[model samples]
Target: MRTVTVLGAGSWGTALAIHAARRGRPTLLWTRTPEHQAAMAQERRNARYLPDFPFPEGLRTTDDLHQALDGAELVICGIPSHGMRAMMERVAQDFATRDAPAPMYLIAAKGIEVDTLSNMHQVLAQELPPSHRGRIAALGGPSFAAEVAKGLPTTVVVGSEDAHVGMSIQALLSGDGVRAYVTDDILGVELGGAFKNVIAMAAGIGDGAGLGDNARAGIITRGLAEISRLAISLGALPATLSGLAGLGDLVLTCTGGLSRNRRVGIALGQGKKLEEILAEMGMVAEGVKNTKSAYRLAQQQGVEMPLVSTMYAILYEGMAVREAVQALMGRALKAEREW
Candidate 1:
C-alpha cells in the first residue's frame, strides 16, 4: 500500500485521511496542536473538528512532523490558506535535512493568500525547493468533510502542470464512494476553488437578509460570471470555470448550510460583526479572508469583479451589508457580458 501523510487534522484533512485509510493506504494525519493529537490518538476521532466520525482502523495520528512525514509517498496538505506558507516552509526544511524521499504533494486547501495573494499551489512553489515544485497538485470541487467522512458519494478533480501528477492523484484517491477526475488546467482549478467562496458569502448574505430566492440566484449567477472573467484574465480556460470546480462548487457552497463561508455571511447579514461571527464559528471561513486578496488581485489584473469588490468593502471597510447590496443593484447598466 502507498504510504500517505495528511498535514492538518481539521475536518477536511481528517476526512481525506480517513478516505485514504479506508481505501487501504497507510495514512498518517498530523496536527500541530499536541492536545488535538492526544485527543485523536485516544478517541480515534477528532473531537474538536470531526467529533462524530471515528477514524478508520488503518489511519494514525501524530504531532511530530518528522514522524508523520516519514516514508510518506504522497502528502496531502489540508492546512488553511493563511498558514500554508509557513507550514510549507517547515516541510521544506524537513525535506532538506531528512533522508526520506520527497512525496508528491496534493494540496486540498482552498483560497488565495491574504498578503501575497498567492494561491495554494503558488505558496507551495515559493516555499519548496525548485526540485520539489514539479510534484505538486491540487484537489478541489464540491465535496464537504462531513459527507465525505460518512462515505457519501463525492466527486472532485485534481489538477497539475504535469498531466501524470494529476492522474496519479486521481488514481490514488478515487474509490467506491469517492470519484476523482484529472485536469491539466491547474490555474482554472485553483482560481475556481478560491473565487467561489467569495460568491458563496454574497449568496449567504442575500439569504440572511431575506432577499428571497431571486436575489440569491442572481448573486450566484453573476458571481460565476465575475469568477470566470478574473480567472480568464489570469490565463485560466473559460470552459474550466463552468465545470465542477467552478459552477459545481459555487452552487454547493452558496446553497449548502454546511458551508462555513456562507454561515459567516449569514451572520453578517443578520447584523453580527465579522469578528464576532468568526469567533463564534471557530472555523476558518476562507471567503472572509479571501475577499481582500481577490479584490486586490482583480485590481492588479484589471478584471472587473464588482461582487468581490463589494464584499471586500463589506468585510474589511465596515460597509453595511444592505448598502453593499444597494451598490450592486445600482451599478450602471451595461450589456450582459459573461467576460
Candidate 2:
C-alpha cells in the first residue's frame, strides 16, 4: 500500500486524508495542535472543522511532524497560504539528514502569500531544497470539503511543471467519486484557484446588496475575464482559465452557498465591519487576504483588474460595498477586451 501523509488537519486536509485511508492507503494526518490530534484520535472525527464526518479506520492522526512524514511516498500540504512556507521549511528540516527518495508534494492550499505575493508552488520552491523542488504539484478546482467528505462526486485538476508529476498525482488521487485530471499549466491552476476567491466575494457582495441576477451574472463573467488576464500576465495558458481550475471553480465559489469568501462579502454588503465579520466567521476566508495581494500583483504585473482593485479598497480601505459596485459599473466604456 502507498503511504500518504497530509500536513494540516483542516476540513480539506481531513477530507483528503479520509479519502486516502478509505482507499486503503496508509495515511497519516498531522495537526499542529496536540489537542486537535487528541480529539481526532479519540473521537475519530475532527470536531472543530469536520464535526459530523467520521474518520476512516485506516486513517491515523498525529501531532508529531517527523512521525507523520516517516517513509511517506506522497505528502499533501493542506496548510493555508499564510503558513505554507513555514510548514515547508519544517518539512525540509525533518528530512535534511535522511537520504531517501523525496516524497511527491501535492499542495492542497489555495491563496497567494500576502507578504511575498508568491503562489503556493513558488513558496514551496523557496522553502524546499533544490532536489525536492521538482516534486511539487498543485491540486485545485471547485471542491467543497463537506461535499467531498460526504462522498459526493467531485472533480479536480492537479498541475505541475513536470508532465510526469501531474500524471502521477492524477493516478494516485483519482478514484471512486473523485475524478482528477492532470495539467502542465500549474501557473494557471494556482492563479485560477486564488483569483476565484476574490471574485466570489464580489458575487456575494452583489447578491447581498440585492443587486439582482443580472448584476451577479455580470460580476461572475467579467470577474473571470479579469482572472484570465492576470493569469496570462504571469505566463499562464489562456485556455487553462476556461478549464475546471478556472471557470468551473470560479462559478462554484461565486454561486455556492458554502463558500467562506462569499460569506465574508455578504457580511460586508450587509454593512458588517470587516473585523467583526471575520471574527464571527471563525474560519480563514482566503479572499479577505488575497484581495490585497492580488491587487498588488495586478499592479506589479501591469494587469488591469478593476474588480480586484475595488475589492482591495473595500477590504482594506473601508470603501462601501455599494460604492465599489457603482465604481465598477461606472468605469469608462470600452470595447470588449478578453486579454
Candidate 3:
C-alpha cells in the first residue's frame, strides 16, 4: 500500500488523512504545531477539528515535516493558499536532501495566491523542483470536511496536466463512499475552485441581508459568468467550468449551511466586521482571501468581474454591502450573452 502523508492538520487535512487511513493505507497526518500533533497522537482524534471521528489504525500524527515526508508515496497538501509557496519551499528542501524519488503531490487547497496571483498548480510549478513538477495534481469539488469525515457520499475531481498523474490520484482516493473523477483541465479546475468561494460569499451576503432566492439565483448565474470569462481568458476550457469544479462546487458552497466562506459573508451581511467574523470562526474562509487575489487577477487579465470587484471593495475598501448591491444592480444594461 502507498503511504500517504497529509500536510496541515486543519479540518480538511484531517478528513483526508482519515479517509486514506480508513481505506487501509498507512497515512501520516502532519501539522506544524507541536501541540496539535501531540493532541492528535494521544487522543487518536483531531479535537480541534473533527472530534467525533477517531483515527483509524493505519493513521499516525507528526509535527516534523521531514519525518512525514521520509517514506511518503503521496503527499496531500491541505495548507491554505497564502502559505502554499512557503510550504512547498520546505518540501522542496526536504526532497533535495534525500536521494529518494519525490512523492506525488495532491494539492487539496483552493484559492489563488495573493502575492503572485497564481493558482495552486502554478505556485507549485514555481516552487517544486522541475523533475517533481510533473507529479503535481489538484483535488477540487464540493466535498466538505465534516461530511467527508463521516464517510458520506461525495464526489470530487482530480486534475493534472498529465493524465497519468490525475489517474493515480483518482485511484488512490477513490473508495469509501467517495468517487473521484479525472480531468486534464487543471487551470479550469483551480480557477473554478478558487472563484466559487467568492461567489458563495455573495450568496451568503444576500441571504443574510434577507434577499430571497431570486436574488441568490441571479448572483450565482452572474458570478459563474464572471468566473467563466476570466477562466476562458486564461486558456481554460469552457466545458470544465460547467462541470464539477465549477458549477457543482459553486452551488454547493453558495447554499450549503456548512460553508465557512458563506457563513463569513452572512456575518458581514449582518453588519459584523470582517475581522470580528473571522475571529469568531477560527477557520480559513478562502473566499475572503480569494476575493482580493481574484479581483487583482481579473484586472491583470483585463476581465470585467463586477462581483469580484464589489467583494474586494466590501472586504478591503470598506464599501457597505448596500453600496455593493447598488453598484451591481445599477450596471449599464447589456446583453446577457456577450458573444
- Candidate 1: tens digits of C-alpha lDDT, residues 74-188: 9999999999999999999988887765689999998899888888999999999778899999987999999999999998989899888888889988995999988888888
CA error at residue 287 for candidate 2, angstroms: 0.7
RMSD (Cα, Å) for all candidates, in order, is 1.1, 1.1, 1.0
Estimated TM-score for each candidate: 0.98, 0.98, 0.98
Return the TM-score for candidate 1, rounded to 2 decimals. 0.98
Enumerate clash totals for all models, in the order shown: 0, 0, 0
C-alpha-based local distance difference test score of model 1: 0.90
For model 3, how does the per-residue alpha-carbon lDDT over 1-339 read when each residue is reduced to its tens digit? 658999999999999999999988999999989999999999999999889999999999999998999888899999999999999999999989988776899999998999888899998989998889998888988999988989999999999988988998899889997999999999999999999999999999999998889999998999999999999999889988998999999999999999999999888889999999999999999999999989988898999999999999999999999989998899898888971
The lDDT leader among the candidates is: 3
- C-alpha lDDT of residue 61 in model 3: 96
Name the better of 1 and 3 by lDDT: 3
List the candidate 1 regions with Cα displacement exceeding 4 Å: none
Which regions in candidate 2 have their CA more than 4 angstroms from the true location?
none
